[model samples]
Target: MKNHRKGHLINKGNAPYVLLAPTILIFVLFMIYPIIRSLYLSFFELKSGCYQFVGLHNYIVLFHDRTFYKSLFNTVVYLVIQVPVMILLALAIAVLIEEKFLRGKAFFRTSVFLPSITALVAYALVFKVLLNGDHGLINYVIELFGAKGVNWFYGEWSARIAIIMAITWRWTGYNMIILLAGIQSIPDSLQEAARIDGATARQRFVYITVPMVKQIILFCTITSTIGTLQLFDEPFILTSGGPNNATITMGEYLYDNGFRYLKFGYASAIGYVMTIIIFLLSALQFKATAKGDTD
Candidate 1:
C-alpha cells in the first residue's frame, strides 16, 4: 500500500503545483500582498490607531505640500546632472581599461571596482568627514593653496554637489564594469577593419564602438535613472537632507513621512506617486531607446 501511494504521488497531475506551492505562496505574501496593501492604504488616513477612508485626501495634501515639491525638484536635479556625468565617466574608464597596451590592467580594473562594493553607510560617512566645513581634508587642501575653506554642508548648491560627488564615486565603477563587459564582447575584427579603413581612433569609437554597445548603454541609463529616482542613503546620512532641504530626495521625504511622522497612509500615497513616476519614466526611456534603434 505504501509503495503504491508513493508511486501515485509522484505521478499525480498536480505534482508540479505541489512542488511550486511554497514559492508561489512566498511571492504572494511578500510581493503581491504588499503592493495591494499599499494601494489600499494610499486611499486611507491613519487616525487614532485606525485607518479611515479619505479618498484622495493624502494625494491632494501631498500636491499642496511645498516640501514634497522641493524634494521632487531636488531629485530631478540629481537625476539630470549626475546620470550623464557618471555614464560618460564609466564609458571612458571602460574604454581605457580595454586598451591592450595599457599596463596594470588588472590593478586598474580592481581599483576602479572596489568603491562599488564598499558599504553604503560607510562611504557616506567618509564623504561627510572629507567635506566637513570646519576642518575637512578638502578644505585643508584648499587652504594650502591660499584659499579659504568653503563650508560644503552650509551652502545649498555645495551640499547638493557633495551628495552628487558621493553618489558618482560609489556607482561609477559599477557601471564601468558593466560597460567593460559589453566592450569586451565586441569582435576584434571590427576594430581592425575600422583601422584598415583609415578611421581615426575617435571616429572608430563614435561610429563603431558606441553603436555596438548601444543596448548596453541603454540598459545602464535606465538603471541609473531608476537608482537616481530612488536615492536616499547618501542624502540621508551625509547631508541629512539639510542646507535648507536642497539635497532632499523623494526617497528621503518618503522615509520622513512614513517612519519619522508615523503617517503611514500619507507615506503610502507618496510611494504610489513615486511608483507612477518611475513607471512613466521607464516607459519613456523604452520608447526613446526603441526610437533610437530605428533611427
Candidate 2:
C-alpha cells in the first residue's frame, strides 16, 4: 500500500508536465529551431541544400559592404529623429485628451487614432500620390506660392523626410493610446491634491504626471527603438531606399540579401548583427531611463 501511494504521488506530479509537453514541443520546433538554424546558417556559404563552412566570412563581408553601412546610418537617423518626435507628440496628445475639461474627447481621440488603424498599403499609396513632385497634392499647395514642387523621393534628404513623415503619421497615435492608458491608470486623487496645493498646470504635469508615466514612457521608448531598428515597409514602399540607397534600412538590406539576392547566409548574419545592436541599444535606453527616474 505504501509503495502504491508513492507511485501515485509521482504520477500526479508528472501530470502537469505531460499536459505542457505539446506546447513546449511546438515552441522548440517553431521558435527555437528557426533561430538556431539561422545562426548556424550565418556561419556558412549556403548553396542548394549543402553549406560550406566559412566561419566569420559573412560578417567580414558585411564590414566591407557599403550598402550595409548606408543602411545602418539611415536606420540610426530614423531612430534618432522619429522616435523622439513620435513619443513627444504622443505624450502631448495623451495629456490633452485626458484633461477633464476637454470636450469632444471621444471625437478627438478617435480621429487621432484613426491613422494607426488605416492599412499600411493604403497610407503608403496615399502618401506617394501626395508627395509626387509634378502634381502631388502637397506640391500643388506649394505651387500656389509660385514655388516649384519638391522631389520628395528623388533627393536623399527629401526621401528621408518623406519616410519620417510616413512613420510619424502611422505610429504616433498608437503611442498616444498607450500613454493615455498609462495616464488613466494614475489615481485621480493625486492630481486633485496637487491642484489643491495651488500647483500650476505646468507644475503638476512636470512633477506629478511625468513621474507617474515614466515607466510607460520607457516602455514606449524601448518598443519604438526596436521597431525603428527593424523598420522596412515604409522605406521599401515609399522610396525603394531612394535613388542613391539614401533611405535603405537594416531590415531592407536583410530582405534584399535573403530574398532578392538569394544570399540567405549573408542575410542571416545581418539579421543577427541587427539583433545584437537592437538589444544593446534597448539595454542602454532602459538603463538611462531608470537612472533619470532615480534622479
Residue pairs clashing in model 2 are: none
Please write out the lDDT profile of model 2 over residues 107-197, one tens digit for every residue. Answer: 9999999999999888998999999988899999999999888999999989999999999999999999999999999999999999999
Write down the RMSD of all candidates, one decimal each.
1.8, 2.6
Reference-based lDDT, each prediction: 0.94, 0.93
Best candidate, TM-score:
1
lDDT of 1 by residue, 108-215 (tens): 999999999999999999999999988899999999999999899988999999999999999999999999999999999999998999999899889988999989
lDDT for model 1 comes to 0.94
Model 2 lDDT vs. the true structure? 0.93
